[model samples]
Target: MKKLYSNTLMQLIIALCTFSFVACQEYSIDSQPEGPLNIQIDAQDSYTALATSPSNVVFNISSNTPWTIESDAQWCVPTPSMSASSSLVSEIVVTMENNTGKQSRTAKLTIKAEGISNTKVVTITQASKEDLVVIPYDELVATEGEDITFTIASNKPWEIIPSTAFISNIDKKSGTGNEDAFEETITIKVPANAGARREGTITVKTEFMTYTFTITQNGVVIEQEEDPESTTISVGGTSTGGTVKIRANKEWKVEVPKEYQSWLKAEALSDTELKITTTVNNQLSTRVGHIILKTKEVVDGFEGITFDINQSPAFWFNGSSENRVIDEATGDVKIMAVAGNNVIANYAIKKGHLTFELADINLNGESCLHFNLWPNAGNANIKLWLRSNSDCDFRCAGGFGWGQKMFSLTTEELNAIRTIEFFVEDDPDNIGKLRVRLSINGEEIGNLVNQTNIYETDPSNNPGQVINLQFEGGLNYTEGDYYTVKSITYEPAE
Candidate 1:
């Protein structure tokens, strides 16, 4: 019976030990802590006003657990007395007593939260009484020879100092402070600037701080002679030049258009005169160019002066008596052709003559005749000739046989308004022989036609020779062919 009792007690002991171990294991696995402690603040540093006028800085706090706030300085007090724990977010207002001492003062605020090993700290700083002053403007612009006004607000005494002699006539240079910020009007007069623009500064000095106001004044104005003689000048066709005058207080420059720069040129003779020059006007049409004169400085009233230059044409004839020969008896000026829809000749009908009686001009040297002709559909036959007089026969004339040998034009050239030019000059190589060159639309074509002894020297072959430019068409070809002469001109040798 004794052995049975002892074995029963040992079995009971082992079962109790096993049950206690299992219960301990279950409790350790199910009851585990989560996450870490966190705290955040909106500001790490804050600023306050001077001691006489105290300012409040509000701090926003966020914490996962409950938190408390405390300040290290006696002069800085945090409101809502965070002696107890507050969860989530809390806004605490901190009132700071301004530092009356010479140096600025700072205080540290400590925020503590439960279960967090580290704490958050914010530093608050307060400005001293001597560091406070409010000036209205930092920089100002004053007109030439004018006065400028501005106000300065401060609670302390201040005195003004000008950097240069240009700044003068100050209304109030020094003033005493008051309990509240008092505004004082400051008026400064700037003398007129005769040279370049000037800049200076006005320094405001107090017991401890210094402030500055910059002043800028404009320079003198540019003046020019408003009522001059004239702005238009004329030049002759043989490259003769002219000049115009311009008087200004400042230096001036001329700007010419790019297209006319090749032929036109301008030079400044002095502070008042400008000379205009040009190359020879070879074409039969008048040419005009414009130029601008500008001063370096700002003008009082004028922006720029514009000048016009007119160049005369070398020789111009458009079915008018200006350069043509009119019949004395009938007073009739021969008409060659018209422009656009005015048809000069139609091959389907009878033959037509496009003739021009040029004035008795000496063509012994170099001469050129230019005209625009339009042949419809490229189906036409035309002939051009130049004689000294009407009595001269076709065989004795010096001209081109259009649509024939050495002067054949392409279909594209025939369909458009073609610019035909005839050049007659004494051959350089052969003195007596005349060199006749032809071109279409500024492009030279056909070999240079050389005619020897065809001028006044040979009277039998060429009679009544006076250099008359004429054209006769409609000798041969298709029925629907037609042509028109838009314009014609003669440029005699210079």
Candidate 2:
């Protein structure tokens, strides 16, 4: 019976033990914690009246925070604060003051719900004021040989005027507080015998302004010439060519146009093209435009020589002796002259003519001669013949019709020496012709065409043009030195 009671009790004990173990395991488990309520605050940027912004100052907080800052403000002043929806909070302000003395302050902000706090330091500095300064403080200038004074019988209190001059000082004073400003005169007086221009200075300073005064006198030395002004004659445009007038008290230099440059090939105009004038004074000065045409080839020259229509050399003869004579060097080359008879330099002979005894010639494949004819006009026939020192003779002797005139002629042949005689059978008009020649060589095997030069019909080659002497030839030799003036003679060829 005892064993049976023990067994029943053991079973009851086993059941009670199992129920207790299950209850312990169930009670030990806990509920999941709410994910952190909100992020905590960390630190903030320092505040400044001089905060160069558009640049952000970041405050690192436990992430997942919705943060925002107050952005409304005036120049360098903070009126609003920064806030966050998270557990932590940060308050800050930007403030400005009198712009002088400066210091820093910090705010200790505690974050609720989160065991965190934030701090923002603010530096306060003095502010700039609008009521200050003296304009362009370079010293004032006073002319010499004169008396200058600064009258300051009235001015602000606590104002001190610094001086770099002898007479700059406190003369009288008035006014008080901010109603303060001064009025005083600094006098600069030149001695009766003051030398030339003199100088001095006055320095002044006040709470609101600072300045320096400059003084001077005339110089002692005398310079009595009026400076020359750069005068210009501007052509309105390429619009029209007309008169351009210039005005000046003194002399001047002006540039001229290209059209006038041809006629007025001059240098250093007394003035320039049209003229420089004074309307008020009616003064006409030698300093006005005086056009002068200068030769372009000043360094070289008008390369070729000039002659009269008649082509006479008499215009070139100027001496103190016989009016007419002969040159021993060029074989009786006539030297007769009566003021203006002229002749061309190089002349060429026509179809039939011969030149002889030409001197000073370099034998340039051609021949030339110079002579003068009687001024009166007339007509006649001239005869020509050829000769050679080498006995190489070729005669194309013929009579050439001509007018009473002196002129140069060119013929073909260096050794083609030609002698021409104008047949003055009856120079009823008392007229004559001067002759010159251009010559070139020839051969029996080759019939070379002789090149010749022609003249213009009218005598209008002056004001606008010149005689264009066209040269022609089979060989076309560039002009050399053979052409020379030898002599002149007359023969009648009816």
Candidate 3:
């Protein structure tokens, strides 16, 4: 019985040992030397890019199981095109096509490890690319001695070459850059052109393309002028007129007309030059005068030189403390008036046409131009007043008071430089009544009969005789009030 019991114990120990060896083999198989399936890559990837250039990014991955890289974006492509990775440490390259789009782009890339929970995502971003641009001028057609500029832009280094020396003065020649493009400016200066049209070209070269800029310049122009040989000479002062130099080979003599002898004088400076001097005309009318210059020794095919001279009309002033004549700083003629001042004229405007040009008629206060008329015989004296209102239309005194007629002229029309014409006629039917016609700037308004009847005569006697002309600045005028009369002329009406 003891031998049988010992044998049973040995059997139990053998069974326990066999079970332990099986358990060890299974543990060894489960704990094999393969690491977790994971991909090691940057969290975000970015690339600065230029137009027409490719961009790339690479990711390193280590995994026990197979791994693959994928992106749904069309512009993003994965390298190693076959399939997943076969090696433990493999590279997944992502390539972006040459950027043709004008804006930046973004994409997401996913890395998947098969049979493992290791998934990695990479956010990819790229900057927008700028195209090669030339600003302002591409082709220049300019005149001689003109300056032309060309602006160049590119992602890479650039160079500019001029075709000829005709274009010079280059401000800048080359530029250097990387992802972002830089601008370079070059200026072309053209020389003075003598005769014909000139042409040239500038070649701008960059990494991607080449630009050819062209230039053409016009020739010079020559012209000749014809006239009365000399410009009309205007004399301002009373004592001395300006001097004129003539290019002549011989001696010359100047002859002054008879009527102008009192004011005009000429002296020979040298054989070919003459200096003309004059005194103040003091007359009311501008002088239409000429001086003849003849070569003492006659030359072939040469008549003498004749110069036309114009002496400005003498300044008119009533000499009253209230009103005076003022020569403007700009050399314009003006009349200044205060209250109760009168500028009277010697010659009257009778039954004829009277024309006057006004530079400006701005009135700070109420005033009018006055005309006094006297008939031939047995007629009453006539008084006519001319005035303007805020609307720039003409107003005059009729039979009664201040506001009689408004000429219907807008303010703009009245302010502009204008000509005023007035005509007076003798009345045959009514002995005392006179007819008046008025026009402004060549447009005639209607006629007025018996306007004021200021001057009246016996039917048989001659009428429409003007006694005198005068200006009265009424009670409203101040110290600074002024007006300008450009010109005045009178003639018999047709």
Which one is best on TM-score? Answer: 3
Question: Where is model 1 poorest over a 10-residue stretch in terms of lDDT?
Answer: 345-354
lDDT of 3 at 315: 36
The 10 consecutive residues of candidate 3 with the worst lDDT sum are: 220-229
Task: Give model 1's TM-score versus the native structure.
Answer: 0.31
lDDT (10s digit) by residue, model 3, range 39-98: 444435544444356556765554445666778678888775323544334566777876
Query: How far does residue 265 in candidate 1 sit from its true spot (Å)?
Result: 1.0
Give a tens-digit lDDT track for model 2, residues 116-150: 24423333332223122223223433323345455
> What's the best-to-worst order under lDDT?
3, 1, 2
Off-target runs (Cα >4 Å) in candidate 3 are: 1-289, 293-316, 320-332, 340-343, 369-414, 426-434, 443-446, 450-474
List candidate 1 segments past 4 Å from native. Answer: 1-230, 281-286, 296-303, 318-383, 386-417, 423-434, 441-494
- TM-score against truth, every candidate: 0.31, 0.22, 0.32
Q: Against the true structure, candidate 3 has what lDDT?
A: 0.57
